[model samples]
Target: MNDKNSTEPTQPQPPKNNVKGAWNQVCGWMQENLFWTVAYVIALLTTVLVGRELFEGDHSATFREWVLFFLATILFFGAVRFVQIFTSCIREDTQKPGQEGESKEHEILKAKELQKIELQKRSWLIFSYSFMLFALFAALLPFVFDVEQRSAAELSKRPIAVFVGCVDYSTDDEAHSREELRCQLVDSAQSPAPGTQAPKPITSLTQQTSETTPKPGEAKTSDTTDTTKTEYAVITNTTKTMPTDTGIKTEVTREITFHRYSKNGMWIINIGGMVNRCNTDIYCVRGGLSVPLYFVILALFGGAISLTRRIPEYQKQAYPKYIQIDEKRPKLQPNQLREYLVFQIVQFISAPFIAVVAYYLVVPESTVVSVTLGFAAGFASETILLMIRAVMDKLNPSTTRSTQFGSISGYIEHNGQPVKDANIRVIGQQGLEAKSDDSGAFVINSVPPGEHVLEIKHTTGTQSKDVRVNSGQATSCHIKL
Candidate 1:
């Protein structure tokens, strides 16, 4: 009994012990690599301040100001690149397999290889993210620092004109040919009147109405020669001719007031369908530091990957005697291809949810119904695909029950926190499968039922576990990696 008890295996200790050490190492690396990050943040803030001054201040650009601007630009780029390189270095060092005591030449060679990989990763990240950041900055800066209004002279230069015509007046007894006139004026052109002074053009027209009648006590008389002369007031049009030779050209001047150095100066830009507005001063001060927030996210991802890499190491340590390797499966069949296609279709359908969220938060005044329609279309397509798959499975029970038909539903995590865009894979007797999305949760359906292996695969490391799935049921699994 004692021998049997001694031979029995004890449960492996949790890697919880390494957490503190790993955190400490990560913090140390961050502190060392973040020198440029700090500088960038400071320079960015300074730029914002200077930009505000430029917008609101009455002072003209001085030689010193130009020099400082040049320096700030340099510092911004420098700090950005430096932090990028430093993070890359740390990522590379963590990925290396050998210990510190390896032969110097071998270590150097490994370092070179690691450096090459880091360079590639950094290049890709910087190229993609920096372009996005710069584009956003370029867009918003103009709106913040510039304010424009139309001048009165410019308004006066707009087309305005007046027209004139004549009409006749009449009473019940006899009609009189009274010349009733109307006048119109236009202000856009030079005054047509015969004077140097320009007159304000009449903007609108009005008419007066009146009636005349004799008293009831007046004796009735016929042809007594009481010819009463009726008078009427009217406006007449006049034309003024210009001398052919005097051709004096008139020019209108418009005034524009621009801020020189105001801290409140703001600019807004909308790019890639994202609308953002910021104070010129604030953007200048913080733009450089903004790049590293993405880096921090990447590093956190890297750390999670690094810690998970130890899983394979620990597997080797714990299961040395039980090691077994399986042969890879053959090429997928038509049905298999369809299954994979359906899964991909579902993933594609879910992608627009992010876009919907982006639109709502970023562009509040946008048509909500249109966005909703797009989302409905995408989601409906996915739902239809799912129904098709379900119907197909129901029609062919054997096919659905086969070892090739399985589903993997799981959440992605980093540092024990859910992380979006983390990829997951499920390896089964039939073949390899994968799925991922922005929400950090994924489901790889149409996989073969029965005992199959699941794995988390990423740039940093891979982890695997065995799970069993019953036909028509999705297998639930949660992997920290």
Candidate 2:
């Protein structure tokens, strides 16, 4: 019986290659990147549409609506991806102590790790360039389409019309009284008649003013005619008409129009007792102004193309496919910082363009459509490319793979309670071992995929159990001591 048990070989789980297996894999992939993929498709369509609209005149409001719909979708996905990135960055800041260890592994595994890092750097570099190219394309779009010319012509035809209406008014009597007082004040301020004396101060409402002393060379005047000017147009009282058997009142209405034009950049017009001043020009519109939008688009394209292809000259120094360095770090020492910069620069270049594109798709005549489209393309292209790259990476399997490793993790308990700080040992594999955490959880990583005996030891007692670990799978086991 012992011989039979020792000689037996554990069969590995078959590769998931059936219809169901393919479906599951596809579903899983979609679950991870479906939103991003959809966004990519929409962005591509918008780009094509915008390009078409620039060269052709057949695009209508419906096309703009479709573009807007896609843009909104992209924005939603971008927001979600941004959140995920932020959370992941936060999580990465806190290091997991259990995962780090000094490995006496062979050179080939180390080489593979280096290759993976290199591949990641290349991927990001390519993504950054793609972003910059898209941005450049957006910035130059208006210029290419001669949108400024169209806007100038449109402005000429429209000539900017403004309208105003009375919102409220004071009681009629109150308004008339205020106007009368204003007129009296204006009359009092008028200059005295030439060669006439300044008027003397009045004492009472019925009293006449005394004569003023004239200058030595000028004649004096009694001015008993009441020199103070009178406002004959002032309404002193409100009159009420006789009411009929049925309650009714008469109303009067009038319409007035004024035409005005700007001279030397100044314009003044009155409408509904409100004065408006406006200065208009083509330069006031951002789209009409001469800006190097094309330069931006070119930069994006150049950056995207240059960074994407791995230059043979830089590979050995910048990122080595295999590192002989004794340090645990993968790739060149400076690669991480460069990688981080690439990511940040790509994001910065793409953000504005993304917004512009989204806006343009919805508003066909929008001034910043180019910038928006550029931003949308730049922002989302990275995520789209990442999905493709990930799929490709999985498809291209390494022929030199060593015996694959899997992991086993479980809880150690005592009378249904967690046994904290328990020791876990795997028979025959010195590399496979772990210690239970405060939650009585233990994980033995990089275990050979096969049947293994797990020994759990605590201060109180010990327990043993058999566990089967499949390649690339996490096997769970529970042990009671």
Candidate 3:
């Protein structure tokens, strides 16, 4: 018997059949994965198209036009999916020979203007997406390069000063002053010494002298000679009081000489609240990129997270042909529309906005934790909304979602003994009744939150009690029989 069993187990089998079956299974799953792959590809293409609108320049949109084809495919997928979901939910959709409906007019009406308008709308519809994936990705690109490239590239690093100690200006600066430097982005040691102040203007005028001609005393002119003073320097010594450090006004007479200088050689810039300098524009670029990185980037990532979380759900609702669950062609469901599908699409589109709202609710004590929380919030957008409703209910106690139903739990007892098999009915509400067990205990749930009447009946007698039910809390009713 052992030799027979061994021979039976060793019987030759066709290896091709086994390989074929395994290949079939692989193909089935590959098709299913392929659907999602296409959806994600469309998502990528949609982002690219949207980016064209955002970052316009002198570049051919050839690659982007191909992306638009992906958009059309995704829309077709959506239309088909919507119809399938709607049709499956329908109970009865039958056609009778005598009950057929038909249009009265033989020819359908069409307008050229309406057709043109629809075409334009169809063209613009190619760019919208479920989330802002590429925008977030693009926004993060600069920080990797522009913000800290030099520091990151250096091999000898971690000297603390290398990261935080660099400033745009220093006293040793050869040319630029402290306030004048713009794009050095590193410390310098070429400036003038500290406290070497520039010369202050001599405000007090002590005396004025002419510069146009020689003075009368020097020229040996007549004793009564008169000199004409033009706006040009005149040869007159005018005495005036001068400001003194000793608090005494001193008067002095002296000759003043005027010198000519080129207009291009002089300049004065008054530093104000804004410093719009630098050819590289480092500060502005850093400021723009960093704000979004710190405060807004996580929200976008969270939106992406929300997209990831819904992949399975989207797959579930999809037509079998679209989801490709197996190798066999699925029986195509009839096209029908449903309200639930519309809401699901709405949730997908609004996820990014919801994530942005959630971003503000975080306290950024730790950046990693904050970013994680933001992504969590986006992934759990519906959960966050429910939490918000719960908080509102707790705070106000009157919101619609806060309206809670009370429950009832009790038992029947008589003279220190439990009553068995007692029936209980709620008067105010329907379809909610309970019966006591051998232990004389019973519980009623989902009783509308308000005042209610409970009627209890047993072999001995019937007892009725008026009870108060509070929203979201359970009530108790103990009966004596």
Candidate 3 lDDT by residue in tens digits, 1-481: 3664454545787567888889999778668767655655566676666666644778665554545554555555554444433333332112112223544341132233334433432222222223224334433543543233232214122221111111123345424222221223311222435888532222122342322322222222212222333221233454343333333332334432221111111011111112211111122111110112333445445555554444334434433225435423221222111232244445545554555455434334465765665555545566767756776677874545656788899988976789888878776476789988989999899888877767676766555666888888888777776
Q: Whose TM-score is higher: candidate 2's or candidate 3's?
A: 3
How far does residue 453 in candidate 3 sit from its true spot (Å)?
Answer: 24
The C-alpha stretches of model 1 lying farther than 4 A from their native spots are 1-96, 99-104, 124-136, 145-481
lDDT of 2 by residue, 125-203 (tens): 4544444454444445434432222222233344331221111113453322211111111122345689986443221
lDDT of model number 2? 0.45
Q: CA lDDT of each candidate?
A: 0.40, 0.45, 0.44
Q: After best superposition, candidate 1 residue 423: deviation in angstroms?
A: 12
User: Is candidate 1 or 2 superior in lDDT?
Assistant: 2
The sequence of per-residue lDDT tens digits that candidate 1 reaches over residues 112-138 is 866665465435334434433433343
Show the lowest summed lDDT stretch of 10 residues, model 3. 260-269
TM-score of predicted structure 1: 0.23
